[model samples]
Target: MAAENQHQVPPPPGLIASLAGLAKNCLHLLLSRLELAAIELTEVRDTLLQLSIVFAIAMLAAWFAIAFGTATLIYLCWEAMGWKILALLAGLFAVLAVALVLWGRSLVRQGKLGLSSTMAELKSDRDMLL
Candidate 1:
């Protein structure tokens, strides 16, 4: 029995080594994917910041232009229409502003600003894992 046990080969050494190596590789892959996700999030944040700044500047400029244009129009018609043009212009602008506000609200309700690509990538990753 002792002779037979001695003659029997030990399990292959590569088995344990291969399992360790696979675990290490999986850890590395997970770290890489996390890094990629972080990078993408940073890019999205920077883009949003830039867009916010641009939109704020645009809104300011538009407000100034509208104010000046309305003033100019009122001045031009002041002599001909007396003070009545003021009321008409005010009412017209109010109606238009309300319409624009409603349109903007509708767009917001529709969630047009969702992170579509990021969500898609996450979904794909989930599918791959499953």
Candidate 2:
């Protein structure tokens, strides 16, 4: 029975050719996946770099505008106007500060603004639930 079921083996060339084809196909699949991953990584890197650069430029512009405006205002106030205007400016600032404090308190009472204590209380509640 064993002798009757015995089959002839394929030629060496045929086996080698099949193995080479399989290897080539596997290498192609591996390279395609690697190429896709590389492209996705490059796109992510580029997007992050662009976002960081834009944020930095915006911060720099904000700082420049603040410094320039403050300097211009001080120069106009001290050099252009006399010392008498300084007293009036101080009084105006005091009044504005008082007004802002009152307004902020009113908003807090109305629940329109969250003060530091309120924020802490909300955070504690969220933590407890979580």
Candidate 3:
């Protein structure tokens, strides 16, 4: 009769304690998984940051190389070719510019230029604005 009464009563505190312990264990497992994920994410971010830094540095170095090469070429030409050659080159450049302008005018007369189409599109867009 006494054992039956005990069984009928609410289960002892031990079962409730065990349930709390199980909950804690589950929580700890979940937290550890989250920590692992965070660590991986941090590592990935660091790697990406490093790669971006390296790429920027490489671009900067390449730009420096290009600037140095252009300056060197100009210096060599000015020093070796003398001022007379430089003057002649400048005259040639002016002539080339004039020739290109005349050629462009001829092409416009032939209707080979796309500028009119572009200008029409621009005008249409401008009309829509008004």
lDDT scores for all predictions?
Answer: 0.83, 0.69, 0.70
Off by over 4 Å in 1: 1-30, 99-113
TM-score for each predicted model, relative to the true structure: 0.58, 0.36, 0.36
CA shift of 7, model 3, Å: 22
lDDT of 3 by residue, 88-119 (tens): 66686689679979986896688532344445
Query: Among all windows of ten consecutive residues in candidate 3, which has the lowest summed lDDT?
Result: 112-121
Between candidates 2 and 3, the lDDT winner: 3
Q: Which residue pairs overlap in candidate 2's backbone?
A: none
Clashes of 3: 0
Error of 2 at 25 (Å): 0.8
Steric clash pairs (candidate 3): none
Superpose all Cα atoms of candidate 1 onto the true structure and report the RMSD in Å to 1 decimal. 5.9
Poorest lDDT segment (10 consecutive residues) of candidate 2: 111-120
Clashes of each: 0, 0, 0
Better by lDDT, candidate 2 or 1: 1
